[model samples]
Target: MDMDIQPPRRTFIRQMAASGALLGVAGLSGCTASGVAEEVAPGFRHGVASGDPLADRVILWTRVTPAHDGEGDVAVRWQLATDAAMRQVIAHGSVVTSAQRDYTVKVDAAGLLPGHVYYYQFAVDGGDKSVVGRTKTLARGDAKQVRLAVFSCSNYPAGYFNVYADAARQDNIDAALHIGDYIYEYESTGYACGQAEALGRVSEPRDVLLRLEDYRRRYAQYRADPDLQAVHAAMPFIAVWDDHEFADDTWRDGSVDHKTSQYGPFELRKHAALTAYHEWMPIRVPDASAPDKIYRSFDFGGIVSLHMLDTRLIGRDQQLMLSSYYDEHRRFDVEKYKHDVCSPRRQMMGHEQMAWLEEQVSRSTARWQMLGQQVLMARMEYPTAVVMGECSPTNYCALKKRAEADPSCVNEKEQRWLSAQTLPCYLDSWDGYQADREQVFAMMRKHRKNLVVLAGDTHNAWASDLRDAEGRQAGVEFATASVSSPGMEGGYPGRDPDDVAAMMVDLIEPLYYAQTSKRGYMIVTASHEQVRCDWRFVDTVFQHEFTAATERSLRVLPGPGNRRIEECYG
Candidate 1:
């Protein structure tokens, strides 16, 4: 467990109580998402938002709960301010939000100063306003410096998002490139979270999400997190989606989480997920990358070109399962060959996306070209050597997972009795899709050399020096770590996550520096010379007050072969 203590909803209520007293406002806990909870409408219910910044202007988004309550439209006035408070207004206007878009409103505030910070908020009923949101316009493409906070795979019920909270505190970051999985499809405690599921933090619907309402409830719950809210309030975010935002390891047609008719048809489920994802997230409509078109690009002062790729929708091949592994002992018959590494035309990013990615890489003139996308571009291999007596993430974590097999009778409450551990490899990630990995590496080599890959599907931190098609280190570097909704490798019961990660890294020989069973985020800094990355981990996430530190520091020098591990533990 990330923390022995579960999320303290009562603590939040208490904090609200104190803050409410300070502001002479009432703590409104009884309000529903459909209607206003209190007579007082103080600023942002969802908090401030800023995005899609050009040199002069940026996109602004907000929602207003109505007095006709959930059903009626609320005409809200928005104002951009130079000060943190709304005393000085730069641009002011009015927009109406109705039930059509779930009372959400988005407006692009253009014609502002370049490379400058601006504060904006919304006033509902032309009176009460939202929390001030701070945003910055980009410098010209040729500008000298820019930093990015890259992340993905954040499942709210998984744990406290100290990663997002920490990234919010980072220095000099221009924007955040969230490469998907902002929301997950699981409705209950679908995965092993760091805390007890009994916490109201349990994802709503109490099962796998299928209906639009289920998806919406999930988003509202995630957005209710104060840390995630603070990060969004603090900076402009650019995002794309990965599978869990729809379903675990999803593709155009289905997902790993998909079942038969009870969840509805796969297409309908996908449609519902995408519809809700588009509506709730601070993303633009008619995203070009659809089937669930969340992929897009962002240029940072033109010095660094961020090419966001959509790896899931158009070209995703079906995920590999345990069936892909057959015993080499020839002890089993033909049915044993089911999991025989299905490389038969499987893809992580389909052909069209591959071509699009290649074009973007080739066209970039920036000093650093970052492939900001979901999933790792590297082909991680399985650990052929399994220590006979040990099991990791534990059979307990994996056992409880309906993923490979059903939960055994092992009681997690009896965790103290276990001794030693074993490690089995996950068949997801790049390790599951070898052919797709080869194609992407080929593109990186052919189109560009100064490339760095950022990923967040797996939860533990990794630093890999990617090799070219010829097995020569391609000067391309991959920095991927664990999830917002973490997958295995977090170690459980008898396994110390660090020791288990140690055995796996040794067997697979991935170019990883530090892997922790901890929670936190990555911070990236790019100059013309080098791109520096820090894997920051929090001491504990479920606790409100936790210390964060650098678990590892790595660097990819510009024009590279492999990223050099620099000041690893510093």
Candidate 2:
């Protein structure tokens, strides 16, 4: 793959203009050329996007790259219309952009009506207009159905963003939830193989992103993708970062992948990545001083209220490692392990965020309390006996070797259960934070909230019951599969994903559905009565053209007694 930072090919405007043909707004008229509508040209190559929608407003975004390199601080004008023709002008404004902010422009278009679709566009004084983007504000009152296209972990080098393309084509999706790893920091040749060349895709810099410019260029490359742009142009995106936006397995202050000798100060690198992330992603922060403030809430009328959490950076304690348990004696003490895991000092969302979350659940009047977060909240513990007794010797040996390398692979209970053996419990996820997980479940139990968790980062579909300390059903979690990243099946070659899923279901009492062999996103439809989540998988990512199929659908009725999840459709 080439290391060159390719210029935006103006593909979004050229290709989407045909599909998103606009006549003008309903009542207001935009600037015209000789009393005629001019075609969008290559000026705003990165296209246009809208996100972080509120009841009466939305954040509009665009990047203005001057045809010449030295032309800085280009003046760009924008407008919002009630219709596609640019007739019903709702709002209009102008913003200046320069290389300082990577020429990206964002405006919070406020005072618009609630639960209404709006069309928006951007253009320079004499340059071509940008591709018209469609966005919708959140429904305020008496809302019926709300559809959200949920996606995450889209690795540029891994494969095509066919899931995003599929999402762009969906008419029912009112908004989208991008719950982390929107852009991976890995170099082009580092993460996955074959797909890059197969799809002519390569990440910029050709090395791990560590500097501010590195992160900026990477975002430009990702946003340049037509599919991603189309999805953003189609609907507003509620996004939150998980790990990869900065570095792999990032916490509050550091990342496991970062080395001072290689990446300078971790704080500097993290700040750079975050600055670029906020600039590129169409997100709004209440306080710029708090750089890692993506944790926010959104209300979808009375149907659901989404609490987007920053599980990677905000208030997360250092992740526990299983390797700490192994010693020269090779003796594992179960009591010591339990004491360490259940300690009150360890935290996931931190004390403040957890308190805020509980408050959100307690105060919300919405029928469903939706938590849009990164990493799976459901307990996905490995059943060592299943692998040791049923799996092939090769698979068992492989897993055992992996466990030896990372002791955090297994939890205290799983470690005890597999005393002499290994029962890996993907420690990077919520499974590793058992005490904190229990705290969250306790909050749900206290509030009697009809909680529905939306998670990513695992690159696999999981539908499970969230149980409280007393083994009572507290809520239900729907962990959406990744947009492109590989899953456990990819790590364990030759192992059957379905077989592993079946074993997990048998061992993990709360789990009802699981799939690891496919790559796609989830479509969540919420109403006052119930919320339906459909796990849809892309047929193939190696090719440009692909199809999507629903792997499964789980429906949860609000104000539930036990928060039961019924498998509805596929």
What is the TM-score of each predicted model, taking all chains together? 0.81, 0.87
lDDT of 2 by residue, 404-425 (tens): 8898886664455446433435
lDDT of 2: 0.78
Candidate number of the best lDDT: 2
lDDT of 1 by residue, 502-534 (tens): 654644444565474666567788877678887
Q: How many residue pairs clash in each candidate?
A: 26, 14
Task: In model 1, state the lDDT of residue 406.
Answer: 39
Any runs in candidate 1 off by more than 4 Å, and if so which?
1-28, 33-43, 68-70, 193-199, 286-291, 324-344, 387-426, 476-492, 560-570
Worst 10 residues of 2 by lDDT: 27-36
Q: What is the lDDT of residue 410 in candidate 2?
A: 64
